[model samples]
Target: MVKTGISYSSLGSPDGTLPAPQEVARHAEQSGLDSLWASDHLATGAPFLESTVALAAAAGSTTRLEVGFGVLQLALRRLSWAAKQIGSLHALAPGRLHLGVGLGGVPADEWQAAGVPVAERARRTDAALRALPSLLTGRTTELPDLPGASVTLAPAVPVPPVWIGGGSPAALRRAATLGDGWLPAAITPEGVAEGLATLAELSGAAGRPVPRVTVTVFAALDGHLGGLSQDALVDVLHGQFGFPRELADAVAVSGPPELIAERIAAYAAAGAEHVVVCPIGGAWELQIELLGKARGLIA
Candidate 1:
């Protein structure tokens, strides 16, 4: 079965009045959702919370619901610092944290503020991904640039499953080589099939097992579309994320509950092992309830 999760951050709630993370986590667990995800953003014009803090709040409040960073910008922070944060969270909720790492685009100012050269994001991210497991598991690991320095984490916890997120070929290759899962947002079923094929070829060539696949989608249940038409939703998405209309429409799942369920089923058929539904409007609690119903419809 394709597992389903929901985004816990502010992406879908433009009004900025999202419920407390603890409340959201409790609700998700009670609703029987498989996971809860939060995004990492250094700076943004929109209302947002720090991803790690948000996940920690969620994990601390719930027992069964898996908590994840939808895609933490690993390249922006020092690997040691990132590893420590992840390890701490795992200690708080062992066996229930999923780390999704990626090189995020947009808000170029964030990269500049973080002191991460935009041009070297891939390299920095690759190094972080390669070293995180060792650091989190209490095994000594050396920094790539600081060759003589070695460090190990204390009170080590099981390394969380790391999912790589991005749509570029380099991102796919990185996922095939270093990630336990591949996570990409705003992709169509056909796109997923194509990407999975590429991932399979790359993983086979590298003699690694194929990584699990997950996709994040923007969606709204029929009555909860926030009075926006399909075209209006596309426009809003383009303004917020700069996605082209066609691309936005391709990835936007909306309409009746059954229709939403059908769209997710299509993605599962295309080989997605999990789908993270990001509600695209207010009434988030209602959206979560609706999403749970949709998940029941997926085979």
Candidate 2:
């Protein structure tokens, strides 16, 4: 049977407001989602939820569903600290944890906030990667105590799989070299193909085993297809992918159940070991029903 997952994009309803993270999480878990995924963004002209805190609340509520940081903004925050925090949370959820890292946020603002120079981003990113492993292991290993005394996350759990998120070659290379999983966003199939190639190439060069490929898709499950409409699809594409309206609607998977299953199967055929459904606007009940039905199809 094909593996599947679901995400709570936690997109605030039509109005600008943040919902309780725990509610979204509980919904994902009850809905039979393989994993719970959330995006990390720094108030990007919208109501963005804090990834770690939100996930922590989720961990407190669910025992089965896997909790994930769908793409923590490594460029914007202290990765070592983030790792520690995630390590602690993993204890709550145990091995059902996934760390998805990504380069996000405005370069100028993120760097300025952290007092890091823009030109030095690549160096910082590399350093973050280097520092993350120790923190995840809760080994008490030190790395200049990034932004503070180097410390491990509390309530440590076994190391969880790390998934690198980015559509770029460099990102895929990093995922191949260091990550246990590969997760970029759902954009064009061409992008997924390129990312996978880069991951394979880097893994070979590093003599590492191939990492799992995880794909993300935007979906609204209240309908029979758990799909979104062309207009709603455009909204998500613009907000999530920044894709132009026409292009976003053209590629998004939104329709009744049969059609939605077809879209998900496409991803699996393209080499996705796990497909995360990033749910659009809706309550947990409807969302869970959609995922449960989708899971049945995939199973």
Candidate 3:
């Protein structure tokens, strides 16, 4: 069965205000949502919270709902610092934390702010992924190509399952080799099927088990999409993610509960093990409640 999750940030909300993380967490757990997610952004000129801090808040507030970084920009931070933050958050939620890492492509200013060379993000991200598991597990590990000093985290925590996010070939290959799952955003069911096929071939060549698959989509409940026209809804998605108008319209889910449920079922049939839904333009809580109802119709 496919699991259903919700993104906790205000990234896709029509309004800039986001609910308190604690409230969102409690509500999600009570509503039976499987997981809650937040994204990482540095200097995006948007009203976004720091991903790790936000996730920790959510994890601390809910005992059963899994809290995750929808896609944390791991390449932008020093590995040691990133590992420490993740380890600390894991300590709060234990087996309930999911670390979804990605190569963030946005607001060039963010890369500059982090002092990470924009061109080297892929290499840097690969290096971090190679070493993160051991570091988070509190094992002594050598830092790659930096000045000497093997390190180990104090108060060891279990390594959270890492889901790699991106749609590029390199990203898919990395997911096959290094991730516990692949979480791609704004992709169609056909795209997902194709990507998973690539992942399977890559995993086979590497002698690694096939990774789990998850897809993230923007959706809104209600028959009329929170009073926005279909054109306006597409515009919001384009403005936020710069997706082509046609692609944005094609990938976003909107309409009555039955239609939304059918869309999710399509993704499940295409082999997505989890579908993370980001409510686009509506009362966030109401949308979540409706989304849960839609999820129930899938199986």
Q: Give the lDDT of residue 188 in candidate 3.
A: 94
Q: Which stretches of candidate 3 lie over 4 Å from their true place?
A: 11-15, 223-225
Give the backbone clash total of model 2.
5
lDDT at 171, model 2: 75
Candidate 3: deviation at residue 71, Å? 0.4
Using all chains and alpha carbons, the TM-scores for the candidates as numbered come to: 0.94, 0.86, 0.94
Candidate 1 clashes between residue pairs 3 or more apart in a chain or in different chains: none
The digit string of per-residue lDDT tens for model 2 on 1-299 reads: 45667666555676877667787777767766777778886656677778888788877888887788888766666666666677777777777778887766564655676766666665666677777777676677566425546565655466678888876778777788878888877555565666677777789899997788888877766544434665776797798668888667655666555666777777777777777776676665576667667777764
Question: Residues 12-71, candidate 3, lDDT per residue (tens digit)?
Answer: 454567788888888877777888999898977767888998898899988899888989
For lDDT, candidate 1 versus 3, the one ahead is 1
- Compute the lDDT for candidate 1: 0.85
* Pairs in steric clash, model 2: 145-150, 224-257, 225-256, 225-257, 228-254
lDDT of 1 by residue, 236-299 (tens): 7899778998999989966766888898899999999889988776476787788888888877
lDDT to native, each model: 0.85, 0.71, 0.84
After the best TM-score superposition of candidate 1, give how far the Cα of residue 41 lies from its true spot, in angstroms.
Answer: 0.8
Q: Give the worst 10-residue stretch by lDDT in candidate 2.
A: 221-230
